[model samples]
Target: MPKPLFGMAVAFGLLLVILLTAMGSFALFDRLDPPPLDKLSDLSVEVIDRDGALLRAYTNKAGQWRLGIDLDQIDPEFIEILLTYEDKRFSSHGGIDARAILRASWQLLSNGRIISGASTISMQLARLLEPRQKRTFKAKFWQMLRALQLEARMSKREILTAYLTLAPYGGNLEGIRAASLAYFAKEPKELSLGEAALLVALPQSPEARRPDIAPRRALAARNKVLERMATAGIMPQSEVMRATSKPLAAVRHAMPQLAAHASDRLTRENPGALVLETNLDRALQEKMEAVLRDASSKLAADLSVALILADGKSGEILAEVGSPDYLSVARAGWIDMTRRQRSPGSALKPFIYGLAFEEGLIREQTRITDSPVDFGGYQPKNFDMGYQGDVTIRDALLMSLNVPAVALLDAVGPARLMERLKRANVSVTMPEGSDVGLAIGLGGLGITLRDLTQLYTGFVNGGYVKTLRDSPAEASALAQATSNMGAPILDRDAIWHITNILKDAAPPQGAAKMAIAYKTGTSYGYRDAWSVGFDGRYVIGVWVGKADNSAVPGITGRSAAAPILYDAFARSGLTLAPFAKPPLGVQEQDFADLPPTLKQFKLAGLWASPSPVPEEAPRISYPPDGARIELSRTALGRQMPLIVKLQNGRPPFRWLGNGRVFAANGRRRSISWTPDGQGQSTLTVIDAAGRADSVSVFLQMPPSAP
Candidate 1:
């Protein structure tokens, strides 16, 4: 009854089954052997600072700097304009739009020439992922097939991100990020509407629309994109009109060059890493480098400078200006002097005095002669060549007189000083086969600014020391810092004393020294000048001089480096933090409160061997060299018996600063005198044989009225 209709139904079912089977086979083959994106995977390294600010970017193996980007990383309007201009049905189509393809085919046939591209963004991505040199029929077919495969395997957002990342915009400039940075000097996320339109239009014919070479063509292309957007109602009419009138960039900008040395070092340290993040503050780094460059003009063209700023509490290096001008051949700016070892002249005095205070060899009120003194063959003099006759230990240190500093070094012993520095994690290099000597107190040993600054950190950090680092902390860095820190260089009492003294160090004219405790040093023949200072927050070390070690006349830490240091702190905008509270037992005392031996540092018995016979060499026995004698005070607060005694030396002896003077007679070994005041005073005993001994004893007289 229905033979023809039944035959048609059976053939229809068979045809449906055949089409389904063909589709399943094609999908399976496409999944198994998809298009490869091997070429696009070779990305260049991106070096960033602590704040994720770009420092430098390198090119890929193909010598093109095509940074990867995501659709979300760009403005939504940019995506809208791109889709409306390139492919209207991009989101709905599998890969290619059939209607657009048919229209393109009709146009080509009617005009006998290629009219429009029926390629979606995914199709463009396919071509970028597996580029073909020629626009042939076979190439187009493969691109369409690859686009379909990509659409099936990846999400729309992933496909769009890849397209924005890999799209070629002309010679060695690929992707929105690269092109935006090149033309706008900014990131894709920060591009304006006009900037986005220009980028979207350029990829269609990158060479033809290159703004640097053909501004008119780029403008026309961008205007056409805006017109299309307006016609499609993608963006508001006002925005379209505004964007169309905006100008295109006529020149390309170079990429960022912040932290050049740090970035170069990071690449060398962590090769093969696609991205590196450091601990440096890019803004601070750039600012400090600018400061250094500005200061470079004042220095001789042949001289350079180096600076490092680090958080004292954490030892994180915030900024490091390796040289005044890294590219200046005349200044040898390529050398990172912060790591370069140079003499640290008077900069070492604080540590030497610190060691002396630790050993109870001297006190802040101890009276030390600044007159010229020689230790064996080594002789050190003051910077001005004029001694301050008699100066307090604090005065000696604050003034940076070389003689008194050497005297303290002689007392502590040079080897012990070096041992303390090593325990505090400072690398030291002495002359080959030479033993540690007094000259170390005057920059005798070779050391780098890094080591010197680290030592000072220990001195100022309440005896705590740690390794300074430029990049983020690593296990190795922490281990090195751990090995270097924690064991106090001196007791809190000693460290506090050193800090209190250095805090009062005078600054150069028109500089703020109270904000930081700093010291300056000039190497031999003024070859190197250094000013290292620290506040409650950061420790900054600066070195200025010729890299070749050629002496520069009149260059010194006080004049050249200190001024720069203060200026740098001012420019850094870092608030001067307060110093840590002084530890308990760090009592402030005047001269009369110091021990007898501490009153005047003795040099006679420093290296004296045990005496064979009882020789009359003049020895004071009552109040010993370091003896603390407390005299009773009467109601007046300034009355007591201060007895002075001596043993050994010729009979007749004379005591200066005492009303009674002995004549040529058998020495009255013991004598008694009334306290003149409650402060410290130097007591001198001279034997008839011309030998003498001096002791500074603190007499506990009554406190004066406030």
Candidate 2:
């Protein structure tokens, strides 16, 4: 072989050996000392509104406000300025810039001190990941190596994101998002020139130049960034001058805390979620919160207010203020009143009237006695303790006449009313060990403000109740599906009648009339004051009370809560959506023009005069003897209530189930009772005239019983 060829072969062999050794060393280093990325995932949980506006932020386990953000979420100008100020060669460098390092070294040697930083964004991110307490040569060497590894593993954008996310901005705030929100009370998506410069300058010597602590130093640092921008021609001189002229924000604004209770609940339900997106409107939530705060301040001490505003059609909760001030210890503001069940006073009257309408027992124009009357042993009086002698059903409901409502509930059956409300997905809870009675129509039962608002949505949405939801994802799913709507609370015609009557109710003083159909309710002893109203599109429910369940004397629902409801509607900045057209089979008529059966509402064996002589003996008309009846059962196999009717029964009948008295001395011929167990049972009824009837029936469980 030729001598020159041999020499070239030797050189090539040496070069290949060196390259192989370098590759082996790189692989070994990566396996032995990988980057710590677990902390990067420990970002602060954020709750945002429907349009992606921050409602609240929670610190991470480390007690740092390090919100996760991407490039798209940040302003492009801020990115350009940051890149220009931090690393001009960031885009072209592999991880470390050779030119910058050489320049920095030359400056240090020439001045005997550090002049400029040679660390790229990647190196800064490495230092953040494995933070060092002090600057040392070993730390710098490891950071440079980590930077190289990061460049090999992550894209430029990812490195930039990690760096910015972990960049400290004094105190507990770590990241541009926290700094922007804390300093400017806004997001970093659209930052001003001065704001951008301040943010860029914060990461370096963050504690020394904190804007909230040292305004003068912060201002100097921010001006330096602006000057650099001008020198680098990244920003025009005029803009740089304007930016420098702006004063630094010396005080940090509190982070957004809108919908605090709702956010808290969502975060608890969805633990480990980085971002929770709800259906709330930030502007409306802020406005309603302010209104409640202002209104609560004027009320008695320790009295708190809660409000909820939702879209009637979609059931999306736009605003939910659980309390006037979530931080007020005097008000016990941490309690979420919206979810606390309390007596709803007469706010439930419309449903009773609606049930009566549904049963063909009465119409809006039907005359009903509102004077004091006894329903069995349960008697209810009007809130004002004064009653109209005789009034139309519309007028009775408008006035919220308790006697009239209880009478209607007696005819409708308290169990049946509760059943209808349950079908509408409105939760109603009776006091422990209390039987269903007429007094429930007059605020004897308990319901939450949220459920009450949901119940009223049925009236506005043509009788169908919309299940209230706050999460945007859930709302979107609901919009695409109809299975969750469940059954209507009332027939369309009945709901229309109810809506027509309620819309005419007098508004609180200083409030506009005819804007909405509203009802006010004051629980017993003024422990709870409630006003729930609905326009064509929105439903707002307000609750005012002491968190400890103490009474506020002289505080009535119409006086306390109705005004807030009206103010909420006015400040909602929404055009009044027109009510739905009257459903089919609905008619407007005067009292004298109605049918005879529909003109007067009379309770069986109570309101109507009894016959002088018995027409026939009492006989079990339903569940005929020796018949098999299919009854509905709950998931736990408990039998649901059954309605039994008799052909003819005297007043105050006694009903027995399997020799056990279930209902004693009931006046109505039709009665509802729940069977204790599923098999053969004998139901007997004894009338006032000593006439008795008995029937044996077999109850079969429903298909869904478990």
Candidate 3:
């Protein structure tokens, strides 16, 4: 080897040794760690609707309104502008910039004050990740070291993203997203040239240039960024001039408060989660919320309203408005009325009529008396205080005759209707400890708007009960909402008949009624007015009343709730679908073509033929003889009450279970019994003629398999 080459090699060895020693000596760095990249991006828990639109957002534990943001979510122009204004070579540098540092040092020394910053975007990110109040050389050195470490562990994009994620904007705002929305009332992707420049300016001196507090300063600072962009040639000088012509936001707007009740409920349901996506349609929710809010001004001061829209097919809740105003203390708008239990008046009549159709006990043309009737001292009168002596079941339902409903309920037995509702997964609170009676057919019971709307889905669907859900992707919640415990509530023919009757009922004044089938209900004493409507696609339920249950005079269901219901269907963009075509075995006929048994429904009691068929012996039909019945048993070994229904049975009858007489009533066809244990037992029923029928059965717990 040449002597000069050997000398050069020796010099390189000494420099390498000095570099190693310097690195080792600086190894004892500050204990402060970098901000967790995952945590910074996972800032707040947000409730999003079905369309992935934001409904509500909750602040982090530190009470900071830091929303998560993505690099791609921001406009490319803004990204470029941000890069040029902050660090022109951000993508190329590791963490620190040596040339920029030397330039800043000379400027500081020459000017005797800080004129320019030496920190690259990455170094600034390190300072943000572990913020410190001190402005000392040691603190800056530590931050620069952390920046190098960040460059080693993260990609260039990751480094930039961390800065974007944790960058301070103004007030409590941090990151590009928070600034964009606070100053511009839009997402970062929608920022214009001036808006982008303004956002870029705020982070440098957030409080000093905040538009809300310092508009003139904000404008001046924003123009400075525009000038920088012009200097960098990233944005044209002409565009910067035009951008300066743009106005700055004079005030900070509140974050979106849509779906307030749903967000509150869901956040509580899923605590500690960073995101709580729901199934609400953001557009529809906002539209309906506006509808209710607008209606509030026309309504009484203390009155509030709640409404919900659900998809009939999949049963997802598309929109929910819990109250007219969330902050109205007078209206008690903070209460989530959709989940509140309130009486449903005439709205339940459709189900009552459906049960009669399901049983083949009545036809549409069947004549029913709507005159004043006293059922064991309980008298049912119409809202008009007059009676239509005899009307078809079809007209009776349309006009909402209270007497006809109670009289028919007397025929069907209100208890049976309650059973059907419970079977269809509807919850009803019968005046505590009180048995369901004829009065229950006219809003004597209580049910939540959520459950009642779900129940009304029976008419929209073909008799099968499908559970309502917020988000189908949420399996655990879906499981609870849809336990599949519901059995068939009515046949397809039965549901069709009910929808057919109500679909043509008159809509509210000035509102053109579509092919939607809906029912209006007013709770007794005018405390609640409700209307639930359904096309083949959507089911909407609306309630108008005081949150305190104060009676509002003349607030009938048709007069109050029906208007909102009809207006909602007209305004909501959802396509209304036609009801299902009459299914097979559905007999649509005039009075002459109907069967003799269904031609004239006896409103008084059970059907008693003028002439008897002697050979048809009275017998038990349900829970057939010697059949094993798996009762829904509790963990403590108690069983749900099971009813034994009879066939061809006379009115005056006696029922026995386990050799103990439980029911000895006048002409009742079915009786309920609770068993002591799961084993073989005899169920016997005897008619007035002493004709007895018995069935032996074994009761066991239902299978626990999912």
Question: Each candidate: what lDDT?
Answer: 0.76, 0.82, 0.77
lDDT of 2 by residue, 1-706 (tens): 7755555555456445533554456667877889899879999999999998999989999999999998898999999989999988999997877667766665665567999988889889989999998899768777877888889899999999988899999999999999998998878887999999999999989999998899999999999999999999888999889878888879998888789999999998898899999999999999999888767755655778999999988889999999988888878989999999999988888889889888988888889876556565565756544345778888788877777787888888999988887787667888899988887888888999999998888877788888888886565554334414567889898888888888888877556675799999999987998999987889999998899988865567776788888888888898888888887768878888898888887655655322344456688776689988766422112333565767665556788999988853275555556788678999998878899999999986644211
Q: Candidate 3, residues 1-706: lDDT per residue as tens digits?
A: 8755555455455435533543564445423454345547558677888766667877777676788777888899998988888888888876767667766765665567889987888878878877889988768776777777778788988787778877888777877766777777788899899988888888889899999999999999989999988888888789889989888877997777789998898878876776788888988988898778766655656778899998867778889999988998888989999988999988899988888887777889988876556677787777644356678899899988887787777777888898888777768797788777888899888999998888877777787666677754444654445434446677788899998898888876556758898899999888999999999879999998989988975566776677788777877887889888999877567988877887776656442213434534568776788888766521112334565667665546787789897743344454446777789999888776788899899987655422
Error of 3 at 549 (Å): 2.3
Q: Rank the candidates by TM-score, best first.
A: 2, 3, 1
Alpha-carbon deviation at 33 in model 2, angstroms: 1.1
lDDT by residue (tens digit), candidate 1, 1-706: 4755555455455445533553455576696777787755777678877787777798888899878665767888788889888888988998867667666755665567888878889889999988899999768777777888888889998888888888888889988889989999998889888888889899999998999999999999888888888888877899888888776779999877777677777788997787888777877787788778766665556778888887776667788877877788888877878878888888988888988999988889898876656566566766543356678999888878888888888878888888788777678887678778888889887898877777767754677876777777342655475635457777778888888888888876455446688889998877999999998768889899888888975567876788778777878878888887878767768888776777887664534322344666777776766555555422112233454667668756778754345332233565545546666766777878889898877766323321
User: TM-scores of all models?
Assistant: 0.78, 0.81, 0.79
Regions more than 4 Å wrong, model 1 = 1-36, 70-72, 110-115, 473-485, 512-514, 585-587, 592-597, 604-706
Highest-TM-score candidate: 2
Global local distance difference test of model 1:
0.76
- Between candidates 2 and 3, which one is better according to lDDT? 2
